[model samples]
Target: MKKYGFGVDIGGTTCKIGLFETTGDLAEKWEIPTDTSEEGKNILSDIAASLRGKMAERNIGKDEVEGIGIGLPGPVQPDGSVLLCVNLGWKEKNIPKEMGDLMDGIQVKAENDANVAALGEMWQGGGKGCKSIVMVTLGTGVGGGIIVDGKIVSGAHGAGGEIGHITVNPHESVPCNCGRKGCLEQYCSATGIARLAQEALAQDHEVSVLDKAAGISAKTVFDAYKEQDKLAGQIVEKFARILGKGLSNIACVADPEVFVIGGGVSKAGEVLIQAVNQYYREAAFPSCVHTRFALASLGNDAGMYGCVKLVLE
Candidate 1:
């Protein structure tokens, strides 16, 4: 194996770069602003230049490098071609082909950002030691990645692990950001929890700490639940029921060995895990009921780590 590899996680604002030993040890990490001007024409070239500069600074030769693994914000075909990536202003681009040409034909691989994050978690973070796992990121909006047998399950349209879009409440009149109604994101994400809290507060219920909190957020709801607030408990129960049930449904399909929960909402920690697990246990198929649960340890760096792992594979 080569002695070195690089991971590039491109976002709308910046591109996070990480240099790593092929053994999975991160050597150094940094970032460069993403140039989206002119339809992101310069983004790949800029990344290539930055990587070359890094190798030059370290006096490393191209033969010692394995290649680069990239995480993009949109769907990627098996050949590392993107159909459209609004975040990067890219309409139709072949990531590996373009990046390889710029890097003088060094091998390159790419995958959706969320899927790479899951791969990162599976490699050295929460799901370490497991070959199959599902990673759920609970931020403003819900995102997910499914890895089965150490490979990302990017679907035909590159939307494999879209756990959030799974319709939980077909009766829900409110539509999700994806223009769908009653998506799991409507009730399981941080924003979803906040929406639940708002709806709960709107009802005339018993006095609780949440009633007095300055702003209702996922944090406040969890905090109130920790304090044993009656209303907060109800809200959390509802959230857990939906999320656990959603996961149970996923278990019926992917049946991963573990579910690694991450993102800001996951910071609520054990309390959150237990609540959701209870519902998952109740609704999961008996054979899959014992699937483990864990918290993602890599945080924002997960994508970078996954990108490196991609190249290693």
Candidate 2:
């Protein structure tokens, strides 16, 4: 008799579900498109149905599953109520109750997505042996997760590790979706890369090749960097400076043993890591320079794997 668990990572774009052995190895994965409407119950119902179907197909009973865990792309209260999630259009919804109801009394744990990602990294990715690590995802928006002493730090109100929302520039004041200004995300995410590239293109319309590549995005900029596009270099360099400063700030407080960078921008590989590390080393406090920067190893599966880690832990 083998024990298993179900881990679900619910995002605005998709819901990733994984069935894993108690040992944390993912056995199967599935996904469904996310519908971010006030009708979030539909999402919960669908997940329940999916899990039931999986159990039926495998000829397994619910009793065999140790628990069901979820990572939501929103603030999950300690009591399992979602305070607010712009991505899911959820407001004050008791996600644990709702999800448990669907599962007929199965135990469920819910936490913020970033925290889950960190758990996933610790379970199967680069942070496996480490006890304290910070995982940063640089996608359209930036997100962060902190793992300390082998536990996810979900602060009061479950808003712990909201690193992207950290204010890097109060005076520069660029708007963030969190309704704030000058957040670290505004300068370090893939969206930020595009914003920076656009600004550079605006500044020098004549000399750069990006002008010819109108509608260029972060990918284009990275490609251009490989081709030695002057504008792209300038933009990424600036991005590195801001990103490094943000990491250093995080380091000062968390004093994490390792800083893992993941998401779309992370695909830029060594160049991005090296540049940011250089900045982190310079800006970080004396002892903080010892933290090593590494690329995220789990990729998209981190969320699902993390959910498993949460419940099994």
Query: Candidate 2, 17: how far from true, in Å?
Result: 1.1
Q: What's the true lDDT of residue 134 in model 2?
A: 92
Give me the runs in candidate 1 sitting further than 4 Å from their true place.
none
Candidate 1: the clashing residue pairs are none
lDDT of 1 by residue, 1-313 (tens): 9999999999999999999999989999999999999999999999999999999999989999998999999889999989899999999999999999999899999999999999999999999999999999999999999999999999988889999999999799998999989999999899999999999999999999987899999999999999999999999999999999999999999999999999999999999999999999999999999999999999999999999999887
Q: Name the TM-score of candidate 2.
A: 0.91
lDDT for residue 269 in candidate 2, whole number 0-100:
87
Looking at model 2, which ten-residue stretch has the lowest summed lDDT? Answer: 201-210
Q: Put down candidate 2 lDDT per residue, 1-313, tens digits, no spaces.
A: 2498999999888899999998877889999888766556578888888999999999878788888889888777876678777788777788778888889888888888888899899778878788899999999998889999889989976667888889888986568898989988888889888998988877745477788886877788888887788888888888888889888888888889899889988888888888789888889899888799888999998988888777776
Estimated TM-score for each candidate: 0.98, 0.91
- Over 4 Å off, model 2: 35-38, 204-206
Question: Whole-model lDDT, candidate 2?
Answer: 0.85
Q: Residue 49 error for model 1, in Å? A: 1.6
